[model samples]
Target: MNPYQAPLKDMQFLLENVFDANTTWQNMPAMAEMVDMDTAVAILDEASKISRDLIQPINRNGDEQEVRHEGSKVITPDGFKEAYQQFSDGGWVGLCGEPDFGGMGMPKMLGVLVDEMNYSACNSFTLYSSLTAGAALCINAHATEELKEKYLPNLYSGQWSGAMDMTEPQAGSDLRNIRTKAEPQEDGSYLISGSKIFITGGDHDLTENVIHLVLAKLPNSNGISLFLVPKISVNDDGTLGEPNGVSVGSIEHKMGLKASATCVMNYDNAQGYLVGRVDRGLVCMFTMMNYERLAIGIQGLGSAQGAYQMAADYAKERVQGVAAGGSPTGAAADPIIVHGDVRRMLLTIKSITDAGRALSVFTGKQLDLAKHGEGDVQTKAAKYVGLLTPVSKAFLTDRGLDATIMAQQVFGGHGYIRETGIEQFVRDTRIAQIYEGTNGIQAIDFLGRKVTGDNLATLSQFVAEITAELNELQHVSAEDKSAISTRFDNLLSIASHINDNKLTQPALINASAVDFLDAFGYILYGYYSLLLADKAVGHDDANFTEQKSYVAKFYMEKVLPKADFHLAQVSRGDSAIMDMPAELF
Candidate 1:
C-alpha cells in the first residue's frame, strides 16, 4: 500500500475558507507580516511533502523493529536517526517556537497543520519530536535567562532532545503524594533522587543530550517543585560533562507505539537545577502538559485520518459482493464500497474526522488570537483556549479510537492481521485516550473546574456566540439548522439543570461531569460542522463543497443524536448511580 496522503484540500478549506485564518492573522499585528495566505500555503505544502515522502516510509519499519535498550543507552529503529536529522535540519522542530531562541516563531494554527500531517504519516516517529517540543515550551516558560540561553537554542536546533519526569510509581496523578526528593547543594543546584515512570523519550539515540524536566520536592517545601536534569551534564563553558546519575531501568513492551521509547527512568541523586519558584512545580509542569494535551488530541485526529485513507482505499479495490438490487452487468462481485452499510461506516469516520479537523484548527486559532489579538479579542480567545482544551483533548481522542475501530471493521477479517497496518493504527491510537489526561479526568476538569467553578461563563458565552452565528448564516437547510439549535438548547438546559439542582444536590456536578463533557463535545462538533456547511453550501470548489455538505448532513443527522442520549444520561443525574448499595452485589 502507498503511504498516507495528507488531506491538503480539506486543510486548505478550513484554513482559508471556514476559519478565514488569513484575515484572522491579518487582524493580529504579530502575524501580519510573517504568515500571510501565501506563506501559510507554501509552508503547509512543503511540510506535507516531507511527511508523505520522507517520514511515512519509516512507520511500518519502526513498528516492526521497535526500540532496544542495551546497557546504558536505548536504540531506535534504523533510519530513525537519519529521519530525525532531516527533521531537525529543516528547522521544523521550532516551527512555532520563539525566534530569539533560534525558532521560526510561526503561529499555532500552522502547528496544527504540520503536526496533523506528521502524526498521520508516522505517529511513533512523531512522538519523539512532540516530546522535544513540549519540553522546550515548558523550559522557555519557566526557566531563568541563564537556563533558557543555555538550553533553548540546542533544543530548537534538535542538537539535543527533551523529556518530562513526572508520574512516579506512588504518585500517578496525585501530586500531593509524590515522594521524590530534591536536596539542596551549597552552589544552589540540588541532587535529585527519584524514579519516574512512563517517561516518553526518556532515553534515545536521536540527539546529543536528553534534558529531563523533573518534578521533585525540596527538604521543607509544601508541594512539588520542578527541576531541569540532563542525562549528560553541562559545564559552565557550555561543554558536555559526565553523566548526571541518570540511567534507564527498562523500556516497556507495549500493545502499541512500540517504536517510541517509553522508559523507566531512575535518577540517583542526579544534579538538577530548579526551574520555577519553590513549590510551584505544578505550575511549570502544567505549562508543558497543557501544550501536550492539545498535541495529544491532534494525534487522535491524525490517526483517524490515516486509518480512514487505508480503509477507503481498501474498500474501493476489494471486490466481495453483488449490488443490493442485482449483479451489475456480468461482473461476479461488486466492490464493498457499493453497500450502504459500508458507506455508513466510511461516512461515519469521514464526518467525525472532518469535523475533528475543523475543531482542532479552530482551537489553535484561539491560541493565536490569545497571544497576538488585542483587547477583548485576546481575552475572549484566552477564555476559549482554557474552556476548550479539555474538550478538544478528550473528544478528539475518544472519537479517534472510535474512528480507528470503525476503520478496522471495514476491513473485516483482514484488519486483525499485523501487516495490514490498520490494526497498528488502532493500537497506536489507544495511548492518546489514556495519556496527557484520561478522558474521564478531562471531563471532570471540564465540568468541575471550567464549568461549575466559573459557573459556565465561557460555555454560556460560546453558546450565545454560536447561536448568533447560526442566525446570520444563509442557504443552510432548516432541518440542519433546527437540529443544531435544538441540540444546543438541550445542552444549555442540561447546564441549567445542574445549576438549579446543584445547590440542593451537592454531588450533581461530579456525577454528571463525564456525560456533560460528552454532550458538550457532541454539540461542539455539531457547531463546527454547521460552520463548515455554511461555507460549503455555495463555494467555488464544487467537489470540495459537495463533500463538506454531505459530511455536514451526516454529522447533524447521525452523530448529533448521540448528544441527545448523553443529555438524557445527564438528566438522569446521580439517582441511579447513588441508589446502588456498596454490598448489593
Candidate 2:
C-alpha cells in the first residue's frame, strides 16, 4: 500500500481560493480575533504531519490486532494508547472547542480539513477523538454553566474522552422506542438504567475518563431526555471518585473499525445529571448528532481520497495492457495507466472525491457561520446547515463507497487480498454509510423533514444562490453552464412535484426520498465542480488549474447525467415501490 499523504495542496486551494475562508473568518466576531489564513495554514500543516507521520503507521496493525474485551475493561490495539496520548497532548481534540473551556476555538472550516487528514490516516484511531470533540460540543451548547465548567475543560483538554449512547437492542434510529430509564433522585441527580448497544468509544482505556452523553426516559413518562453520565464520578474539586455504575457488557466483533471499541454499555442506575430540559433530549442530542453527521461524511471523503491515491499510484507502476495509442515507455506491456478502463476508474474516484471535499468544506463553513455570524447570516446559515447536514452524511458516504470499490477494482485480484491495504479502506469506509444514521435515514431526513417541512423555501434559496454563482463565474463555458442549469431547473421541478402531492400521496416521501436526495447530490457536485474550475483559472500552479478544469469537464460530461436517472425515479412516485404486498415476499 502507498503511504497516506494528506491532500494539503487541494485543502489550501479550497480554503484560500474557493471558499475564501479568511474573509469569512474575519467577518465573524467570535473567530475574527481567534484565527486567520496564516493560523489555518499552520494548523493544516501540523495536522498533515501528524496524520502522515504519527497515526497512519498503526492503521493496518490496529485492524489486525483489534480491540480486546478483558474482563470489565476494553483494551485498544498496540500503539493506540501512545498515539492517543500524543494526539491529546497536542490539543487537537479541542481545535474547534470554546476557548473559555480550554479550547482553541478555531473555526469549523479549519477543523474539517484537519479531521479529513486524521481520518485519512486511520479511521479507527480518529473516531476516538471525533466522538470526544462532538460530545464536548453538545455539552457546551446545552449543558448548564455548572456542568460546562465542571466537564468541558477536561473534555476539551482530552484528559477525558466522550461517548454517545443512543442505540439499544430494539431501538436503532427510533429513539422513541428506547426503554432506558432515568429516575429522579433526592440529590438533584437521576439514576440511569439501561443497556445501549453499538456505543462507539463507550468504554476505552485511551483516556483517564469516558464521559457519556446518554439518552433516556424520565420516570412515569415516555418523554426522552439527555444526561451526562461519567464512567468515574467527579467530586466538587474535580477529583476522581468511585465508580458510577457504568460497565461494559462486552465489545462487539464488527465488520470494520476493529480498533475502535464498539460496546454493549450497561448503566446500572448510573448517577446522571440532565444536560437539557426534560423531554427534549432528542433536540439537544441533535446538536451533537449534526456535528457527528458531518464528521462521518468527511470519514467517507477521507477514505475515498486515501483509496484514490493508492490506486493512482498503483496504476502507474503495474504493467498491463497496451494503450490505444501504443506504449509510450516502449516496454513489453505498458503501465495500466495507459488503459482506458483504468483511467475511467481513476478519474471517477478523483472527480467524486474532489467535489466531495469541496462540499464538506462548504458545509463546514455554514456550521461556522451559523455559530458565529450575526442575526440574518446566522439564521440563514443555520437553515442551510439543517438542509445540508443529511446530504453531507448520506451522499458523501454513498459516493465514498463507490470510489473505494472502483479504486480496489484497479488492483484486480491483488485488491481482494488484505496485505495490499486497499481492502481495509473498503471495510473501514463501509461503516460510514451504516452508522451515524444510515444513508437511508439521512435521505428520509433530507427530503421529508428538511426540504418538504419548509415547503421548499430553504431549498429555493439554495438553488437561487447556486444559479447566481454559476452565472457570475468567468471561466466556465456557456455550454457547461447550461448543462448544470438545466439540472438545477429539473431539481426544483421535481421537488415541487413532491411538495404538491406529498400530503395526498402519503407514501410518496418515503418511496421517493432516496432518489430525490441522490439527484440533489449529483446536481450539487456538478455546481461545485464548475465553481472549483472557475476559481482555479489563474492559480500559480498551472498544472493544478488544468487538472481542476479537466475534472470539472469530466464530471459535467460523465457524472451529471446520473441526476436524470434519479429524477426519473422520483417522477415515478410511490406506486411501484408501495405496490408489492408484504406477505408476497
Candidate 3:
C-alpha cells in the first residue's frame, strides 16, 4: 500500500472554488498584505511535502519507540528531535502566531489546512508544536508586554515549546474544583504549587525549555488565576537559569499516542508570572482552549483520512474470494473494491471526511470574519463561531473515532495486528474525542452556553440560512429536497422546543445535551454538503462535479438520516435516562 497522500486537489477545490477562502482573505486587512491564492497554495504544497517526506517517516517509528523517561528528563522517540528541528527551522510552530512577535501571522482559515497536514503526518509529533502554538495564543492575548517580549518570540520560533497545565487530579472538566495554589511573591511573580496530569509535551529535549500556562488560585481570590510557568527559569536578560522547582513525576503508559509525553507534572514553588487578573484565569485560558479545540477537531479529521488511505490501498491489493455477481468463470478473484459492503464502508468514510473538511474550513472562516469584518458581519460571524464550535469539535472527533474503527475493520483480522498500522490510527484517533475537552462536555457547553443561553436566536438564524439555501436550489430531486428541507425545519423546531422548556425541563435537557449536539451536528454536515453540491453543480470538470453530487447524495442517504435517531432520543425527554436510581448498579 502506498503512503498517505495529501488531498491537495480536493483541498484546492474547496479553498478556491467551493469556499472562496481567497476572497475572504482578500478583504481582511491583516491577511490581504501577506497572502493570496498563489501564496496560500504554495504554502499548502510545501506543507504537503513536509507531511509526506519529513514527518510521516517518523510516525510509525515514533509509535513503536515511544518515549523514555530517564529520571527528570523525557527523551522522545528516535529522530523526533531532528524532525522537530526541521519543523522549527521551517518556522511552522508559529504559522498563525502574532506578527508583532516574529510570526507569519497567517489567517486561521489557512492555518487549519497546515494543521490538518501536520496531524495527518503524525498526530503525536504535531502535538509538541501544536501545544506551543496554543499556549502562545493565550499569552499573546492576556500576558503583560514584558512577559510577551520574553516568551512569545522563542515559543513562536521553536526555540522554546509550550504546555497547558489545567488538568489536576480532582479537576477534569470542572475547573472550579482545582486545588492548585498560587502564592504572591514580592517581586511581582507567584510561587505555584500544583500537580497537573496528562500534560502533553510537558517536558522534552526537543527545545531549550517548555513554557507552561498553569491555572491556579491565589490566597484571597474567588476565581482561578492564570500563570506563566517555565520548566527552566529564564533570567532577566532572557537567558536560561536553573530549574524552577518543576519536575515530571512520571509519564502515563497509554493505549496510543505513546510518543507524546503525557506527564504528571509537579510544580512546587515553581516561579510563575501572572497572566491577566487573579479572578479571570478561566476567561484568559479560553483563548487558548478554543484554539486547541478546533485544532484537535482537525486532528480527528487528519487521522481518519490517514486510516482511509491505508484501508483503501489494502482493499485493492488483498484480493481473496471473487466478489458477488462477478464473472463466475474468472481465473482470479476480484478486488474487494468491487464488493458492495466494502464500498459502503469506503463511501461512509469519504462522505463524512469531505463534509468534516468543509465544516473545519467553514468554522475557521467564521473565526476570521469575526476578527476582521465590520459591524453586523462581525457580530453574526462571532455568534456563528460560538454556535458551531462545539458541534464541530464533538461531531468531527466522534465521527473521527468511528471512521478510524471502521477503516480498521476493512482489514479484517489484519486490522487487529500492529504491522498493518491501521490499528494505530484507531488508537490515536480515540484520544481526540477524550482530550480538548471530552465530546460530552462540548455538548453540555453547546446546549447550555450557546443554544439555551441565546434562546435559540443564533440557532434559528443558522437554520433559516440553511432553509433559504435549500429553497434556492436549482434542480434538486424531490427525495433530496424533502430530506434536506425537513432536517432544516426539524433543527429549528427542536431548538425552539428546548428553549421553551429548558427551565422546566432542565433534567431532560441535561440528559439530552449530547443527543442534541449530535442531532445538530448532522444538520451542519448536511448544510455543508449542500453548499458543496451547489457550488460544483456546473463546474468545468464534469467528473469532479459528478463526484461531489454523489458524495452529497451519500451523505443525505447514509448520514443525514442519523439526525432522526439522535433527535428522537432528545424528544423522549428524561424518562428512560433519569429514571434510573443512584444505586441501580
Candidate 4:
C-alpha cells in the first residue's frame, strides 16, 4: 500500500459523525444546498488521489532538489512546475473560494480536510497552494470591490499566486517596528520600498504572477498600512505588463520544506495599491492571518499524520525484540509493536492526531457558523472561533512536533536515515510550532489575551461546553464511561483552578501556555475518543470499536496524567519566568 493513503474513512467519520458537518452546512442558507455528504466525500476522494499520486512522489525529491537560486531567478525542482499546473488546472486553489470570483464555493470544513491531506502528502509542495488560498481569503473579505473583481478570479484560479510580506530585517514578531515604507504617487498608486525577509512564495515561476500583500508604514500614518504589489505590473486592460519594482533578492535555505521558496523580497518603488484603509492595515492583514494561523495548525496535523503512517508501518514489519509471551513459541522475533513502549508511542500519535483532526474540523465548523449562521448563534459561534484559533494554532502545532518526534523514535536507527523519511517529518514539523506566531507567543495570546484579558469568559464557556458533553456521556455504562469522565473531570478541575485563582502574571501565564495547550489538547482528544466510542458502541465492526476503546483507554490512562503536571507548573505563577533577569540569560 502507498505510505500516503488518505485515511478516507477516518476523515468521513470526523466530518459526519464527530462534527456533523453535513448538518452544519445544511443549516446555513448560503452553504445549505451547495454541499452534502456525497459531494464532500467525492471531493475528499479526488483530493486524496491527487495528493497521493501527484504530490506524494515529489515530497522527498523536492526536499532533495530543494529550490535553487541563480542570480535573481529561482529554479523550482523538476516536476514541481508541472505538478503545480495540474493542481491549478483542477481548480483546487479555489476549492473554498467565492463563486462570484470563480471558486467552487465549498465549505471551509471541507477545505481544511483537503488541506490536511495535501500537507500530509508533501508539506513543501502544499504550502504554495495553501498560501494562495489564504491570500485570496483576505482580499475577498477586506479589499475594495474593484480590487476584488480584478484580482480574486485570477488568485482563486491559481493563474496568479499571492505572498504576504510583513517581516522585515528589524521586525520579526513585532510588527510595530517595521521599517518598510509606502509613498503615495500622483496616479493614486503607492510607491512601496523596503526589504522583506522570509517571505514564502515571494518569487516563484509556478504561477504567471505573484501578488504580494505587503505591510509598510506611510509618511502620514501612525502605525502601518497593507499594499498589494504584484511581481509584474498589470494594465487596465487586464493584461500583464512590465516588471513591477519588486524582485527576489535571494532565497533562504531552510532546515525542511526545502521546496517552499522562502525569499528575500526587495520592493523598490514597487507600484502598489493600498489594501483597506491606511491606518487599519493591521486589522485587514489579520483577516488573512486568522485563516493562515489555522492553516498552519493543519500543517502540524499533516506532519503528525505523515509521521504516524511511517512509524506504524515500521512497527508492524520490523521484528526486533521478543514478545512478552516468549517469542510466540516458535517465532524468531516478535514485531516491535508487541512492546509496551512502542504501543505507548503509537497510541500517543493516534490519540493526538485524531483529536487534532477533530479540533481542526470543529474550528472550521465554527468559522462556517460565524460566517453564515444567524443572530446570537453567529455572534456566539464567532466568539468561540476567535477563542479557539490561537489554541488550535499553538496547541496543534506544538503537539504535532512532539508527535512527529515520537514517531521518529519508534523507527529508532532507521528513523535517522533520510530513506525512512522520518527525519524530514521531524524537521518539517518543527517549523509549524515556530511559525504562525511562535507557539510561545500563541500561549501568551491564549492566556494574556484570550483567558486573562477576557476574564476567562471564552475559555470558561469552552470548558462549560465540553463539560456538558462529558455530563451527557456519564449516563453510559460504568465500564464504558469511566475513562472519559475521569479524564474529563481532571481537565475541568485544572481549568477551574486557573480561573478561580485569577492569575495575572503574563510571564508565568506565557511560560505555562504551551503546557496549558498540551493539557487542553489531551482533554480535547479524550473528548473525541469518547465521541468515537459512543458512536462505535454496538456497531458490528469489532475492529473499529475495539481500536477506539483501546486508544481511548490508553489516552485517559497514559496521556491525561500530563494535565496534572501542567497545572502544577501553572500554579507556580510567572515568577520562574519573570524573576529571571534578561542579562543573566
lDDT of 4 at 398: 83
* Runs of candidate 3 exceeding 4 Å displacement: 538-540
What is the alpha-carbon lDDT for the whole of candidate 1? 0.88
RMSD of each: 1.4, 0.8, 1.5, 2.1
| Model 2, CA-based lDDT | 0.93
Error of 2 at 542 (Å): 0.7
Q: Per-residue lDDT of 56-134 in model 1, one digit per residue for the tens? A: 9999989999999998889999999999999999998888888889988888887998999999988888988888888
Clashes of each: 0, 0, 0, 1
Give the per-residue lDDT digits (tens) of candidate 3, residues 289-356: 77789999999999888888888898888787787877455837877777778888888888888889
lDDT (10s digit) by residue, model 4, range 1-585: 245988787788878766788888888999987899999999999999999999999888999999999987888898999999999999999998999999999988888899999989999888998889888988888888988988989999899999988998888889998989999999889999989999989988799999999999999666889898989998887789999988889999999989999999998899999889877888998888888999999999999998899899989999998988787656889889999899989999998888788889889888888888999889888888888898889888988898999999999988988988889988887889887688888877776677666776777687778767765763245654555456555655655566555545334555667777666666677677777767666545688777777777777678866766775666566676778789999
**After superposition, candidate 2 runs with Cα above 4 Å error:** none
Worst 10 residues of 3 by lDDT: 323-332
Instruction: Give TM-scores for every candidate, taking all chains together and pairing residue i with residue i.
Output: 0.97, 0.99, 0.97, 0.96
Pairs of colliding residues, candidate 2: none
Which runs of model 4 end up more than 4 angstroms from their true locations? 474-506, 538-540
Candidate 4 or 1, higher TM-score: 1
